[model samples]
Target chain A: MKIKKRLGLILANTILIIASLSVLLPILWVIRTSIANRLIAYKIPPVWIFTPTLDNFRMIFETYPFQDYFLNSLIISTAASLVALLIGSLAAYSIARFRTGDPALRLSMLSTQMLPPIALVIPIFLIMNVIKLWDSMTGLVLAYLSFNLPYTVWILISFFQGIPVEMEEAAMIDGCSRFQSLIRIVFPVALPGLLSAGVYNFILNWNEFLFALILTGRNTRTLPVAISSLWTQQGVNIGAVSAATVITILPVILLTFVIQKFLVRNLTFGSVK
Target chain B: MAKSSFFSNLPKHDQQTARNLVVPAMLGIWVVVLFPLLYALYVSVHDWILSQGGIGSFNFSNYFTVLKDPLLLNSAKNTVVLTISVVVLEILIGFGLALLLNNKGIRLRNIYLFILLIPMLMPPITVGLIWRLLLHPELGIINYVLSVIGLPQPLWLATPNLAMLTIIIVDVWHETAFIILVLLAGLTSMPEEIYEAAIIDGASSRQKFQFITLPLMAPTILVATIIRMIAALKTYDLVYILTRGGPGISTETISYYIYKVFFVALDVGKSSAMAFLLLLVIILMTFLLMKVMQKTEQNY
Candidate 1:
C-alpha cells in the first residue's frame, strides 16, 4: 500500500510538470523566434545556438507604420474604456441605488453582450458610412462602446450592489448629496471592481479585430489589423511578425498582472458570492 | 420675486426634465446598438447591396439562399463541433485542476492559478501567433521535441483535420484557466460542516465527491459552462491567425465565414442573412440555458 501511494504521488507530479512545460514552451518559442535571424530555413533539429539580432525590430518599424498602429490602438482602447467606465458607472449606480429598471430590463442589458458583433457589422458599416465616420478611430471607438458599455453595466452593477447601503447613508447624513455620497463613499469602495472592469474593457477593445477590420481603413488600422495586413504584402517575415506580436501584447499582459486578483475574486461573483 | 420662487418650486417632473435625465445615455445606446440591430434585421430580409446604391427590395431570398448554401452549412457544422469540443474538454480539465488545487495540503495554489491564467490573459491573436510558431512542422519546438523522442512529427496547422484539432488544443489551453478559477472559488466557498459530517460518518473520498462536492458545485459549473459556450461560439482571431480558414475551409467557423462573405467576397446580403441566423441561434440557446438554470436553482 505504501509503494502504491508513492507511485501515485510520483505520477501526479510528473503530469503536472509536463503540463507546465506545455504551457510555457509556446511563449518561449515566440521569444526565441523574434530574435532568430532565419526562422524559415532555421532547420528541423531546431537552431537553439543561433545568434540573436535586432533586425526584426528594425524591419517591422521601417517597412510598416507599426508605431502608428500602436498609437491608434492605444488611443482607441484607452478612450473607449474611459467612456465605458464613466457611463457604465453612472448607469450601474442608478440601477443599484434606485432600482430604476425591472429585472427584465437588467437582463436585457446584460443580454446585449450575447448579441454577436458579426450580426451588427453590416449595419454598423452602413451607419459609419452615412455618418462619414467609416475608416476612422472615432467610429471604431463608438462601435466598441456599444458592446463594452453593457458588459461594464452588468459587472459593475453586481459589484456596486455588494457594497453596504449604510456606508452611503452615513455619508448622506454627514451632509453629502446623493451624488457626493456616491462619489465619495461608493466609488472608493468599488475601486477594485471598477479597475477590473476597465482593464477587461480596454483589453477587449485593444484586441478587437472584426470591427477594426471592417470600420478602419489604411490610416486608422490597429495592431491586429496591421498584423493581418502583414500577410497581404509578401515575404512572410516571421521575425518581424513575432516582434509586432510581442509589442502588441506587452501592455495587455502588464494590465492583466495588475488586475489578476480582482479577476479571480469576481469571476464567480453573481452565482457563488 | 414671490412669483419667480413659485415658478421654480413648481413640480420637478416635466417632459423636459424626463428627457434631460435619460436622453444622453439613451441616445448613445439607441444610435449605436438598437439602431444597428434593427437595421441589420431589415437588411437581412432584403436584397441589399451598398455598392448598388442602397437596399434593393424586401425579400426572403437572401435567407433562403444562405440557408441552402453548402458552404454556410459546413461552416455551421464546424462551429458547433469546435464549440462543443472546447467546452467539454475545458470543463473536464478545469474541474480536475480545480479539485487538485482545492485540496487542503496543496502548496503554492495561488502561483499555480496565476501561471495557468497567463494564456487567457494574453490577446487571442498573440496566443494564435505563439501557437502557430510552436506548431510549425519543421522548425517548431513541438515537432522538434517529438522527433527527439523518436516519434513521428505531425503537421499541425498545415493539414485540415489537424488544424481544427490544433485550434481546439490552443483554445482549451487558454480557456481552462477561467473554469478552474471559477470552480475553485466555488469549491473553497462551499460549506465545510457538511463535508466534515460526511467524513466523520466514515464516507470514502469518492463518495464524498460524488454526493456532496458535485451537487454543491453544480451552479458554478453551469455558469462557467455558459460563459465558455458563448465565447467559443464567437471565436475568430485565433483561427484567423492560425489557419485563415484554410486547408480547404476545414476550420471555417461561422464568424470566419461571415468575415469572408462580407469583407472578402463582398456579398453583403448573404453575409447579413448569415449573421442574422447566427444571432437567432445564439438567442435561442441563451434563452434555453437561462430557463434550464432557473429550473435547476428551483430544484436546489
Candidate 2:
C-alpha cells in the first residue's frame, strides 16, 4: 500500500510538470524565433539550435514606421481610456448614490456591451465618412469610446455600490457639498476600482483590432493592425513577425503584471459576495 | 407648518436634482451606442452601399439575398462549431487548472497561476502570429516536435478540417486563462464547512466533486461560459490573422464572412443584412443566458 501511494504521488507530479511545460512552450518559442536567423528559410527538421541575432529587429525598423505605430497606439488607447474613466465614474456615482434612473435604463445600458462590434462598424463607417472623421485617430478613439464606455459604466456601477454610504454621508454632514464629497471623499475611497477599470480599458483599446483595421490608414495604423500587415504583404518574414509580436505585447504584459492582483480580485467579484 | 413642509420635501428635491445631472451622461451613452445600432438596423433593410450613392432604395431584397446565400449558412455553421468546441475545451481545461491550483499543497501556486495567465494578456494578433509560426507545417515547432517523437505530423493551418481545429486550439489556449482565473476565485471563496460535511458522510473523491463542487460551482461556470461564448462567437482577429478564413473558406466565421462581403467583396448591402442577422443571433443567445444567470442567482 505504501509503495502504491508513492507511485501515485510521483505520477501526479510528472503530469503537473508536463502541463507546466506545455503552457510555457509557445511563449518560449516566440522568444526563440524572434532572435533566430537563417532558421526562417529552412524547412530541414526545424532546427532548434541557432545563433541569435538582432537582424529581424533591424529589418523591422527599416521596413516599417514601427515607432509611429507604437506612438499612435499609445496615444489613442490612453486618451480613450482616460475619457471613458472620467465619464463612466461620474455616471456610476450618480446612479449609485441617487438611484434615480428607471431600472430598465441601467440594465439596457449594460446590455449594449453584448452588441457585437462588427454589427455597428458599417453604420459607424458611413457616419465617420459623412463627418469627415474617417481614417483618423479622432474617429478611431470615438469608435473605441462607444464600446469601452458601456463596459466601464457597468464595472464602475458595481464598484461604486460596494463603497460604504456612511463615508459620503459623513462628508456631506461636515460642510461638504454633494459634488465636493464625491470628489474629495468618495473618489479617494474608490481609487483602486477606478485604476483597475482604467487599466482594463486601456488594455482593451490597445488590443482592439477591427475598428483600428477599418478606420485607419497607414499613418494612423495601430500596432495590432500594423502587425497584421506583416501577413498580407508578399515575402512573409516569420522572424520579423515574431519580433513585432514580441514588441507589441511588451506594454500589455508589463501592465498585466502590475494589475495581476486586482484583475483576480475583480474577476471574482459577485462570486464571493 | 408651511416651512416644515418645505423642509420635509428637501430629500425629494435633492433626488430630482441628482437625476438631472446624470441625464447628460446617460444620454451621451445612448447616442453613442444605441443610436448607431438602431441606424444600422434601419440601413440594413435598405439597399445602402455607400459606394452606390447610399440608400438607393428601401427593400427587403438585401436580407432575402443574404439569407439565401449558401456562404452565409456555411459560415454560421462553422461559427457555431468553433464557438461550442472552444468554449467546452476552455471550461474543461480551465476548471482542471483552477482545481489543481486551488489545492492547498500545490507548490508555487501563485507563480503557476501568473504564468498561465500570460496567454490571456498578450494581444490577439500576437497570439495569432505566435501560433501561426508554431503551427507552420514544414518549419513550425509543432510539427517539428511531433516528428522528433516519431509521430506523423499533420498540416495544421493548410488542411481545411485541421485549420478550423487549429483556430479553435489557439483560441482555447488564449481564453482558458480567463476562465481559470474566474473559476479559481469562485472555488477559493466557497465555504469549507460543506466539503467537511461531505467527507464525514463517507463520500468518495469523485462523489464529493459531483455532489458538492459541481453544484456549488454552477453559477460561476454559467457566467464564464456565457462570456466565453459571446467572445468566441465574435472571434475575428485571431482567425483573420491566422487563416484569413482560408483553405478555400473552411475557417470563415460569421464575423469573417461579414468582413469579406463588406470590404473584400464590396457587397455592402449583403454584408449589412448579414450583420443584422448575426446581431439577432447574438441578442437571442445573450437574452437566454441572462435569464439562466438571473434564475441561478435568485436560487442562490
Candidate 3:
C-alpha cells in the first residue's frame, strides 16, 4: 500500500512538472530570442546561450518611431477604459437600483458586445473620416467605446446587483440624498467591483488591435499596430520583432499578475458564481 | 404606452434620475455602435468600395457578390473546422489539467497556476509573435528541439497542411488556461461528501469520477464550450499577426477573410454583407448559449 501510494504521488508530480514546463518554455524562449544577437536568429541549431544585447530595443527607439506608438497605446487604453467605466457604472447603477431603460435595453446593450468589429469598422472609418477624427487617437477611443461601455455596464450591473439596496436607503434615512447616498455609501461598497471591472476593461482596451490597425496613422499607432508595421522588411527582423513583442506585452504581463486574483471571478461572472 | 408614461410621471424624481444615469451610456452606444451598424447596412447596399467612388444606387447585389465568392465559402469552412477543433482540444486538455491540479495536496499550486495563465494573459499579437518566431522553418527553437528528439519537423506556417494545424495549436495553448480555470473552479467547488461516500462504498477512483464528477462538471463544460466557440469564431489577432492568410489561405478564417475583402480587395459593400452574416451567426450562437445556460440552470 505504501509503495502504491508513492507511485501515484510520483505520477501526479511528473504530469504537473511537464505541464508547467510546456507552458513556460515557449514564453521563456521569447525572452531568450529578444536578447540574443540578431545574426544568430535563423541558425539551424538554436543557440542556448549567447551574449545578450539591448541593440534591438535600442533600434526600435532610435531607428523607428516606436515610442510614439507606445505612448499612444498607454493614453488611449487608459482614457477609453476610464470613460467607459464612468458611464457604464452610472448605467449599471440605474439598472440595478431603479430598473431603468426599456425592457430591451439590457439585451440591446449586450448585443453590441456580440457585433463583429469588422462590420462596425466600415461605417466608423467613414464617420471618423468625415468628422476629421480619422487616423487620430480620438477616433480609436470612440471605436473602443462600442465594446468597452456595454461590457462594463453588463459586468457592473451584476456587481451592483450583489449589493443590498437597503444599505443605500439606510444612508438616505440618515439625511443623505439619493445621489449623496450613492457617493458616500454605495460607492465604497461597490469599489472592488468597479476596480475589477475597470482593470478588465483596461486590459481589453490595451489588447485591441484591428481597429487600431485600421484607424491609426503613422503618428498615432498603438503597440499592436506597431507590431504589424514591423513586417515590412524581407529578411525577417526576428530579434528586433521579438524585442518589440516583449516591450509591447511586458506591461500586460505585469498587469495580468495584478489581475490574476480578480480574473476568473469576473470573467465567468454571474454564471460561474 | 399612455399608462406607462403616466406611471413615469408619478415617480418623476426617480425617472429623472434614471434617465440622467442611463443616458450617457445609451448615447455612447447609439453614437458608436447602433448608428454604425445601421450605416453599415446602408453601405452594404451601395457599391461604396473604400467608401469613395464606385458608389451607386442601393441594391442587394453585394450580398450575392459575397455569397457567390468561392473564397468566402473556403474561409467559412476553415472557420468552422478551426472552431470545432480548437474548442474540443481546449475542453479535453483543460479538463485533464484541471483534474491533475485540483488535488489539495499539490506543491507550488499558485506558481503552477500562474505559469499556466501566462499564455492567456499576454496580448494575442504578442502570442502570435512568439509562436511565429518558434515556428520559423529553419531556425525555430521548436524545429531544433523536435530534431533533437528525432521527431518530424515540417515547416509549420510555411506549409499549407501544417499552417491551419499550427494556428489551432497556438490558439489552444493561449486559450486552454481559461477553460482550465473555469473547470478547476467547478471541480473544487463540487460537493466533497459524494466523493467521500463513494470512497466509503469501496468505489474506484475511475468510478467516482465517471459517476459523480463528470455529471457535475457538465454545466462547466457547456459554459466553457459556448464561450470558447464564440471567441474562436471571432479570432482575428492571431490570424493577422501569424499567418496573414498565407500558404494558400489555409489559415484564413472568416474574420481574416473579411479584412482581406474590405481592405485588400477594396470591396466595402461585399465585406459589409459578410460582416452582417457574421453578426447574425454570433447572435445565433449567443441565443443558443443562453438556451444552454438556462437548461443547465434548471438541471443542476
Candidate 4:
C-alpha cells in the first residue's frame, strides 16, 4: 500500500510536469525567436543559445508602424470599455436595486451576449459603409458595444445585487440624493467589481480581431488586425511576425495575470463565486 | 410589457430613476446589437448586394440559397466536428488536471497552475501565429526536434487532414486552460465535510469520485460545458490566422465561411441568412444543453 501510494504520487507529478512544460515551452520558444536575429530565428537545428537583440522589435515599430497600431488598440479598448462601464453600471444598479426590468429585461440583456458577431457584423458593416463610418475608429468602438455593453451590464448586475441596500439607504437618510448616494456610497463599495468588469471588457476588445479586421482601415487597425496583416504580406518574415506576436500578446498576458485571482469569478460571470 | 409590469411595482419616483438609468444601456444595445440583428434579418430576406446597388427585391431565396449551398454544408460539418472535438478534449484534459491539482498530496500546485494558465487570455491570433511559426515545415523547432528523435516531421498546416488536426491541437492548447480554471474552482469550493463523511463510510477513491464528486460537480461542469460550447461554435480567429480555412477548406468553420461569403464573394444577403442560421443552431444547442442540465439536477 505504501509502494502503491508512492507510485501514484510519482505519476501525478509526471503528468503535471509534462502539462506545465507543454504550456511553457511554446511561449518561451516564441520569446526566444522574437529576440533572435533574422538568420538565427529560423536556423535549422535551431540555435540553443544566442545574444538577444531588439532589431526585430525595432523593425516592427519602424518598418511597420506598430506604434500606431498599439496606440489604436489602447485607445479603442479603453474607449469602448469605459463607455460600457459608465452606462452599464447605471443600468445594473437600477436592475439590482429596483428590479428594473425584472425577469424579462435581465434575461434579454444576457441573451444579447450570445448573438454571434458574424450575425451582427453583417448589418453593421453595411450600415457603416452607408453612413460613411466604415474603417473609422468611432465605427469600431460603437460596434464593440454590441458585446461589451451587454456583458458589462450583466456582470455588473450580479455585482450590484451582491451589495446590501442598507448602505445606500443610510446615505439617502443622511440628505444624499439617489445619484449622490450611488456616487458616494455604492460606487466605492463596488469598485472592485467595476474594475474587474472593465478590465475584462477591455481585454476582450484589445484582442478582438474579426470586427476590427472588417471594420478598420489602415489608419485605425488594432494590434490583432495589424499582427494578422503582417503574416499575409509578401514572403514569410518569421522574425518580424514573432516580434509582432510578442508585442500583441505581452500586455494581454500581463493584464490577465494582474487580474488572475478574479478570473474564475469573472469568466464564470459570478456563477461559481 | 414586462418592463411596464416591473416598473409599476416600483414607487413612482423610483420608477423615474430606474427608467432613466436603464434607458442609456438599453439604447446602446438597441443601436449596436438589437438594431443590427433586426436589420440583418431584413437584409437576409432581401436581394441586397453591395456592388449590385441596394436592396433590390424582397424574397426568401437567400435563405434557400444559403441552405442549399454545398460550402455552407461543409462548413457546418467542420464546425460541428471542431466544436465537439475541442470541447470533449478540453473537458477531459481539464478535469483530469484539475483533479490532480486538487489532490491533497500535490506540492507546487499553485506554481503549476500559474504556468498552465498563461495561455488562457493570450490573443488567439498570436496563439495561431506562434504555433504557425513553431510548425513551419523547414524552419520550425518542432520539426527540428522531431528529426533529432528520428520521427516523421509531418506538414502540420499544409495537408488537409493534418491542418484540421493542427487547428484542433492549437485550440486545445489555447482553451483548455479556461476549462481547468473553472473546474478547479468548482473542485476547491466543494464542501470538505462531505468528503470526511465519505472517508468514514469506507469509500474507495473511485467510488468516492463516482458517488460524491461526479454528482455534486454536475452543475459546474454543465456550466463550463455550455460556455465552452457556445464560444467554440463561433470560432473564427484561430482558423483565420492558422489555416485561413485552407488546404482545400478542410478547416473552414461556419463563421469563417460566412466571412468569405460576405467579403470575398460580396454576397450580403446570403451571408446574412447563413449567419442567422448559425445563430439558430447556437440558440437551439444552448436550449437543449440547459434542458439536459435541468434533468440532471433533478436526478441528483
Candidate 5:
C-alpha cells in the first residue's frame, strides 16, 4: 500500500512538472528568440550559448510603424472600454433595478456575443466604405462595442443585483433625488465591478483581430493586423516576429493578472459565484 | 428640475424607465450587430464582390456556389475534427490538473494555476506566433528535444496530418486552463459531507468519482464544452497566424475558409453564406447549451 501511494505521488508530480514545462517551453522560446543574436536564432541545433541582442526590438521601431500600431491598439481599446462602460452601466443599472427588457430582448443581447465577426465583416466592409469610417480607430471602437457593451451590461447587472437597495432608499430619505442617489450611492458601491468590467472590455478590445483586420487601414491598423502583415512582404524573420509578439502581448498579460480573480466570475456570468 | 418628485408617485413607472434605459444600448447593438446581420443575409443571396463593382443580382446562387464546393466540405470536417479533439483533450487535461491541484491542499496550487493560465491570457495571434517559432522544423526546441531522445522529427505545420495535430496541441495548451478553472470551481464548491459520507461507507476513490463527482460536475462540463465549442468554431486568429490553412488545406476550418473566400478571393456573397452557415451551427449549439444551463439554474 505504501509503495503504491508513493508511486502515485511521484507520478502526479512528474506529470505536473512536465505539464508546466510544456506550457513554458513555447513562451520561453519566444523570449529566447527575441534576444538571440540573428545568426544564433537560425542555427539548426539552436545555439544556447550566445550574446543576446536587442537588435530585433530596435528593428521593430526602425523597419515598421510599430509605434503607430501600438498607439492605435492602446487608444482604441481604451476608448472602446470607456464607451462601452458609459452606456452599458446605465443599461445594466436599469436591468438590475427595473428588469429592463423582456426575455427575448435580454437573450438577444447575450446572443450578440456569440455572433461571429465573419457575420459582420462583409456588410461592415461595405458599411465602412459608405460611411468612410474604414481604417479609423473610431470605426474599430464602434465595432468593438457590439461585443463589449453586451458583456459590460451583463457583468454590471450581476454586480448591481448583488447590491442591497436599502442604502439607496436611505439616500432618498435624506432628500437626494433618484438620479443623485444613483450617482452618489450605487456608483461608488459598484466601483469594483465597473473597474473589472472596464479592464475586461479593454482586454477584449485589445485582442480583437477580425474587426481590425478588415476595418482598419495601414495607418490605423492595430497590432494584430500589423503582425499579420509581417508575413506578407517576403521571407519570415523569426526574431523580429518573436520580439513583436512578446511586445504585443506584454501589456495584455500584465493586465490579466489584475483581473484573474474576476475571470471565472465574468466568464460564467456570476453563476459560479 | 425635480427628479425625486418626478418619480415619487409611480413605482411601476420606474420599471418602464429602466426598460427605456436599455434603449440606447439596444440601438447601439442593433446598428453594429443586427443591421449588419441583415446586410449579411441580403449579401448572401446576391451576386456580390467588392472588386467587381457590387451586387450583380439577387439569387440563391451564392449559397449553392459556396456550399457545393469541396472546400466547404473539407473545412467542415476539419472544424469538427479540430473542435472535438481539442475540447476532449482540454477536458481531460483540465480534470487531471484540477484533481492534482485539489489534492495538493491549496498552498502551491494557485501558483500553478497562475502559470497555467498565462498561455490563455496572451493574444491568440501571439500564441500562434510564439508556437510557430517553437515548432520551426529545423531550429525549434521541440525538434531539438526529440533529437536528444533519438526520435524522428516530423514535418509539423508543413505536413497535412501533422498540421491539424499541431493546431490542436496549441489550442489545448491555450484553453485547458479554462476547463481547469470551471472544474476547480465545481470541485471546491462540492459539499465535504458528501465525500465524507461516501468515505464512511468505504467507497473507493474511483467509485466515489464516478458516482458522485462526475454526476455533480456534469452541468459544469456541459457549459465548458459548449463555450469551448463556440470558441473553436469561431477560431480564426491562431489558425490564421500559425497554419494559414496550410499544407494542402488540412487545417482550414470554417472560419479560415470564409476568411480566404472573403479576403483572398474577394467573394463577398459566398463569404456571407458560409459565415451564416457557421453562425447557424454556433447559434444552435448555444441555444441547446443555454436551455440546459437554464434548467440547471432552476434545479439549483
Candidate 6:
C-alpha cells in the first residue's frame, strides 16, 4: 500500500512538471529569442547560450513607434476602466442593496456582458467613422465600455451584495444621507472589490484587440494592433517580433499576478464567488 | 436572504435615490451597447459599401446574400468545429491538471499553478504571434527539434487542415489556464467533512470522485464551459494573427470572415448582417448548452 501511494504521488508530480514545462518552455523560448541578435534568433539548431542584447527592444521602439502605442494603450485602458468603475460601482451598489432593477435590468446587464465584441465592434466602427471619432482615444474608450461597463457592473454587483448593509443603515440612522453613507461607508468597505473590478477591467481593455484593431488608425493604434502589424510587414523580423511580444505581455503578466486572487471571481462574473 | 428585498420594499425617498444612482450606468450602456446594436440592426437592412458610396436603399437581402455566400457558410462550419474542439480540449486538460493539483500529497503545486496560469492573461495577439514564430516552417525551434529527433516535421500553418489544427493547439495552450483556475477553485472549496465521511466508509478514490466530486462539480463545470464556449464562438484574433483565415480559407472563423467583409471587401451592410447571425448562433448555443448541462446535473 505504501509503495502504491508513493508511485501515485510520483506520477502526479511528473504530470505536473510536464504541464508546467509545456507552458514555461514556450515563454522562455520567446524571452530567449527576444534578446538574441537576428542571426542567433533564426539559427536552426538554436544557440542555447548567448550574450543577450537590448537592440531588439530598442529597434521596436525606434522603428515601430511602440512608445506612442504603449502610451495610447495606457491612457485608453485607464480612462475606460476608471469610467466603468465609477459608473458601475454606483449602479452595482444600488442593485445590490436595493435590488434596484431586479430581474429585468440585471438580466440585461448579464446578457450584454455575454454579447460578442464582433457584434458590437462592427457598428461602433462604422459610427466612429461617420462621427469622425475614428482613430481617436475617446471613440476607442467608448467602444471598450460596451464590454467593460457591463462586465464591471456584473462583477461588482456580487461584491456589493456581499458587503453587509447594516453599517450603511447605521450611518443613515445617525445623520448621514444615503449618498453620504454610500460614499463614506459602503465604498470604503468595498474598496478591495472596487480595486479588483477596476484592475480586471483595465486588463481587459489593455488586451482588447478586435475593437482596437478596427476602430483605431495609425495615430491611436494600441499595442496589440502594433504588434500584429509587425507580422504583416514584408520580411518577418523574428527578433523584433519576439521583443515586441515580450513587451506587450510583460505588464499584463505582472498585473495578472497582482489580481490573481480575484481573477476566478471576476472572470466568472462572480458566479463562482 | 437580503437579496430578496426589492427596490419597492425600500422607502419612497430611498427608492428615488437608487433610481438616480443607476441612471449613469443605464445611460452608458444605452449609448455604448444598445444604440450600436439598434444601428447595426438598421444597417443590416441597407446596402452600404463605404468605398462605393453612402448607405443605399433599404435592402433586407444583405442577410440572404451573406447566408448564400460560400465563404460565410464555410466560416460558420469552421467556427463550430473550432469552438467545440477548443472547449472540450481545454476542459479535459484543465480538469486533469486541476485534479492533480488538488491532491493533498502533491508538492510544488503552487509553483506549477503560477506557471500554468501565466497564459490566461496574455493578449491573444501576442499569444498568436508567439506561436507563429515557434511554428514557422524553416527557422522555428519546434521544427528543428522535431528534425533532430528524426520525427516528421509537419508544416504547421502552411497546409489547410494543419492550419486549423495549429490554431486549435495554440488556443488550448493559451486558454486552458482559465479552466484550471476555475475548476481548481471549485475543487478546493468542496467540503472536507463529506470526503472524510466517505473515506471512513472505505470509499475508494474512484468511487468518491464518481459519487461526490463529479456531481458536486457539475454546476461549476457548466459555468466554465458556457463562458469558454461563448468566447470561442467569437474567435477572431488567433485566426487573424496566425493564418489570416488562410491556406485558402480553411481556418476562417465567422468573426474573421465578417471582419474581412467589413475591412477588406468594404461591405458594411453584409458584415453587419453576418455579425447578427453570429450573435444569434452564440445565443442559441449558450441556451442549448445550459439546458443540456442542467439535465446532466440532475442525472448526476
**Model 4 C-alpha lDDT per residue in residues A106-212, reported as the tens digit of each score:** 76766677778899988998899889999888999999999899889888887787788998889899999999999998889999889999999999999999999
Model 4 Cα lDDT, one tens digit per residue, B84-182: 999999999999999999988888899999999999998999999999889989988999999999999999998999898899999999999999999
* lDDT scores of the candidates, listed in order: 0.78, 0.80, 0.83, 0.89, 0.83, 0.90
TM-score of each: 0.91, 0.93, 0.94, 0.97, 0.94, 0.96
Pairwise DockQ winner, candidates 1 and 6: 6
TM-score of the first chain in candidate 4 relative to the native first chain: 0.98
Stretches of candidate 6 exceeding 4 Å from the true structure: B1-5, B285-300
Query: On residues A1-273, what C-alpha lDDT tens digit does candidate 6 reach at each position?
Result: 999999999999999999999999999999999999989988888888899999999999888899999999999999999999999999988888888877677767777877878889988987887799999999999999988898888788877877788888799899998899989988898898899889989999889999998899989999999999988894689999999999999999999999888998988767675
What root-mean-square deviation over C-alphas does model 2 reach? 3.6
Off by over 4 Å in 5: A1-3, B1-13, B105-107, B298-300
DockQ-based class of model 4: medium
Cα lDDT for residue B142, candidate 1: 79
Docking class of 1: acceptable
The CAPRI-style docking tier of model 3 reads medium
Chain B alone: TM-score in each candidate? Answer: 0.89, 0.91, 0.91, 0.94, 0.93, 0.93
For model 6, the docking class works out as: medium
Tens-place lDDT digits, model 3, residues A1-273: 889877876787788789889888887887887787877766668766788898888988888777888899999998889999899999988877776754467656656787777778877987898899988888999999999999888778777878898998788899999899888887788898888878887888788888998888876789988887686553578878888888988888788778666677656544675
**Residue runs of model 4 more than 4 Å from their true location after superposition:** B1-7, B288-300
Model 4, residue A147: C-alpha shift (Å): 0.5
What i-RMS does each candidate reach, in Å?
Answer: 6.4, 4.7, 3.2, 3.1, 4.1, 3.3
Task: Give the distance in Å from residue A52's predicted Cα in candidate 3 to where it truly belongs.
Answer: 2.5
| Model 5 per-residue lDDT tens digits across residues A117-201 | 8787778888988999998888888899889988888778878877898998999899987788889999899998899899988
lDDT preference between candidates 3 and 4, better one: 4
Better of 1 and 6 by lDDT: 6
Per-residue accuracy of model 2 over A132-161 as CA lDDT, tens digit each: 888788888888888678767667776787
